[model samples]
Target chain A: MTIAEQVGAPRIVPGRGIPYPCGDPNLPPAAERQWRRQLVQRALDAVAVAVEHPTIFEVDDVNA
Target chain B: MRIVHYVNQFYAGLGGEDSAGIGARVLKGTVGPGRLLAQLLGAEHDIVATLVCGDDHAASHTTAAPELLKMAQAAGADLLVAGPAFGSGRYGLACARLAAVAQAAGLPALAAMHPDNPGISEAGDAPVIAAGATAREMRPSVQRLAAAVTKLAAGEALTAADGRVIQAARVGQLVEQRAAARAVELVLRRLGGDREATEVPVGGFGVVDPAAPVDKAASVTVALVTEGAVVPAGNPDRLESARASRWLRYPVEGADTLASGAWESVDGGFATTAANADPNRLLPLDAARALEREGAIGRLHGEFLTTVGNGTPVATARRFGVEWAAQLRKAGVQAAILTAT
Candidate 1:
């Protein structure tokens, strides 16, 4: 959750990566891309929504 | 694109914290991450020079930002790249602040730092990429920061992950959720059976500049407000013992002080027995009235406001303040003495 108070923009949940890893290393190459894609899409949605209260947006993983 | 680069003494191979007291110096070519940044930027951009400075000098002394801007101006730089400062507090603060300094000079600029870095607060829309907590992750961080620079060169919007610094907001929370459930969906879903949403995103908290010091404290009506949850016996307003989102006002008109038997503290976070025995301990209605009697102040607002400050989320707390401030303004409260436990 990057509560973008710094930029004064919408908050962002970049799924799970450290300073720069965008996707899970445990996942296969293709699966990692999928997870990463989902995170990006959710981040877009998180910004699109109008939220007054600080919120936690959940990003989906690949379908089980 | 001509680019002006800023790197710390350690990254420029000068020394670590031991050399942090040194002054700023400019070198003609790329050093350290500048080399990698140049590669990421390719032949299209020129690394005019890398300005190296000690983090201590940059953060403690005021000359750092101006020196960087002067170098940029001298080099005719079209862009500025400042730090992927990782978790180094002073270095991070310097990075963000210097980028702001450059931006104010009319140069396009961006910086990178560990998300938790205090410098993020200084990264006011100048664009900041969230970097890893340690330089061990520099390879990826450099890549991300380069990507942000690329966006700047192309004049594109930067995303939070790309280059947005979350100023004044606590970054991320972990909650339970499948990777498959990216958006709002209660239906069961899973991505490789993963679970946990660790980041809780917070919205911008409105900042209220301090009301100019009351022209005269003695001439203005002052109200006493407490967030330690002091209230009348049995908690008539039913304020939550924890994470309270509401405030209550109790009138003190006519009475010199709040009576202990009639009013008591009910904060679950604290043993109220002490305050219950002396309600004035937290509210100080008696002392406040004493001042009123002495004309030490014009008048005390009839009612004081209170809520439990413990564990309240920033959003809830913000709403409580915005709503209450409006009420206080309407009631003509020129100033307030706020006490929080």
Candidate 2:
């Protein structure tokens, strides 16, 4: 299990799967903005309440 | 050379969540993970021993440090290394605290944590910390840490290590740069005075003679100066976090002294008098009168600069002092004696 998973992380926002782990390298800026916004919203939601155990989801799945 | 390494229970070969409750341990010969580091060094270095403690044990017990020290001494280690603990909050704090203690005791220390970890900044610059995260992913990070340690142990000068970013070594030692010292000396020499302008330090600002020195028969101004302690009762400003605070300037009207036992110091590191009895209440009318009688100052300014001074960051404190002095200049304040109690 990953650390976030092992420690019962409240939320997880997938990066571009690169070592740098920030934004998508190929995506346009507007799409990247949307991705960042979605990720931030997830983080805010998690902190609004106390959570136990890991909760993982796709922040910006281009396919989705 | 002997080296000591610290890690949370999980990374110290204890199992996952279930085993985290394990207490501290001192591995005499070699611990499992120290092998990884020792191998990475490839004869460039050796791992004398490993000092492992559970995260909870380090946090819950403030005495966890002495335990680590005892292990380090027993190991005959010359250097100390704590986890590149990633973003693990408790573990990161433990590593940073232990690293600081070791550094203070005249040992070179290193720690590792992700950039986002709070411990990265809190660790200061004394114990060099390279970037690190999970215990499972220890190859490249351990290699980098070993290289830095190896250089130090070999007495070879090091330019910042591969993963560890340079932070100007902010350990509070103000090393005087030769060029800057010479430049200041040259300037002082240009402005001729009997003073040996090169070595003498600069003094704080004093008020210009505004109304001229008054005769002993006339009223004199006794200014009771303060270092911006104008927070309301209970220090509503909350300006006293031990690490960071800024000063503020406040105005006081004619008052000889604050009423006895009227004000109390909250977050201030300095002592305080009742708001009423305090003579150092900025613009203290009563204190000003007393000063006038004592001929300390000719006149008191209407308003006083207010700012938090308790353990303020050096850069912030310097800026505040400049701004406060500028404000006083604008207000035409004459010479004043700053009082602290």
Task: Put down candidate 2 lDDT per residue, B215-249, tens digits, no spaces.
Answer: 42123322234443544455565655343445544
lDDT of 2 by residue, A1-64 (tens): 6543543334444444321122243556466444444443333233333334455555545435
For candidate 1, write residues B143-243 as lDDT tens digits: 98888888889989887757466456455777687656755452233344536433344454443333444555456677877777878888888988888
Clashing residue pair totals per candidate (backbone < 3 A): 23, 29
The DockQ-based CAPRI class assigned to model 2 is incorrect
- DockQ for all models: 0.01, 0.01
Q: i-RMS values of the candidates, in order? A: 21.5, 29.5
Q: What is the lDDT of candidate 2?
A: 0.54
Query: What's the TM for model 1?
Result: 0.44
* Candidate 2 chain A, run of 10 with poorest lDDT: A16-25
TM-score of each: 0.44, 0.44
